[model samples]
Target: MQFICLIYNAEDNGPQPGTDEFGPYMQAYADYTQEVQDAGVMVGGEALQPIATATTVSVRDGKTELMDGPFAETKEQLGGYYILDCKDLDEALKYAAKIPDAKYGRVEVRPVMVFD
Candidate 1:
């Protein structure tokens, strides 16, 4: 089964670049990525640009509408994601718990849908 682990955290809440904590924080991610890759469960993953760079779009009445940033604000923002191939939800959850952000942030794990 394939699962997507949605990572969420406050944009300014964690270690910032140029800070001592930043290096270890990023290294944690690298370590996690390597672990998953070595385990053969890493399908894909990436960290996203800040929410400030996000653009929301919609189409209504044959017209396109664009809005700056996300459509709504929240305490935590979607920061990144990991797609993993696992035996089942149990295994997926196990991996999700290991995600670095899960310590201070959130990781939502959901199974991928397949269409005929």
Candidate 2:
């Protein structure tokens, strides 16, 4: 089975670049990634650009519409994600808890749906 860990945090929250804690914060993520990879559970993961760089698109009434940034403002924003191969949801949640962001933000673990 596979699970996707959706990482969410406030854009202005957490350690920011040019700050003293930034380097260590990033290192923590690297260490977590390596730990998962070494354990053979990490399928893939990546950090996304800030929400300010996001573009939203929708189609209604046979017309295409584009919106800048997120459709709704929220305290937390989707920052990144990790796809992991795990034995089950229990295992996936275990790994999700290890994510660095889990401390200050949230890591939503959801089982991947397969079509056959």
Candidate 3:
């Protein structure tokens, strides 16, 4: 089974790490990535830029609309995501909890859909 882990955090709050905190924070992520890779669970993942840089698009009445920011204005934004291959939802949740942002933000785990 494949799951998509949507990471969310406050854009204004920025990353919690400071100059000194960066090393450990990065190390933790590196370690987690390695562990999941060694287990053959990691499919793909990446950190995203701030919502301020996002462009939202919508189509209505055969017309296209473009907005300067994210689709919605919220304190927490869609920061990044991880797609993983796991045994089940429970297993995916376990891995999601290991994400560094899980302590301050949220990690939403959803099953991926497959089409024939």
Q: Where does candidate 1 stray beyond 4 Å?
A: none
lDDT of 3 by residue, 80-104 (tens): 8989999999999999999988877
What TM value does model 1 have? Answer: 0.95
For residues 1-116, could you state the per-residue lDDT of candidate 1 as single tens digits?
A: 89999999998888889999999999999999999999999999999999999999999999999999987789899999999999999999999999989988899999999687
What residue runs in model 2 are displaced by over 4 Å at the alpha carbon? none
lDDT of 1 at 107: 98
Clashing pairs in 3: none
What residue runs in model 3 are displaced by over 4 Å at the alpha carbon? 14-18
lDDT of 2 by residue, 16-99 (tens): 899999999999999999999999999999999989999999999999999999876899999999999999899899889989
The better candidate by TM-score, 1 or 3, is 1
Which whole-number lDDT from 0 to 100 does residue 82 have in model 3? 88
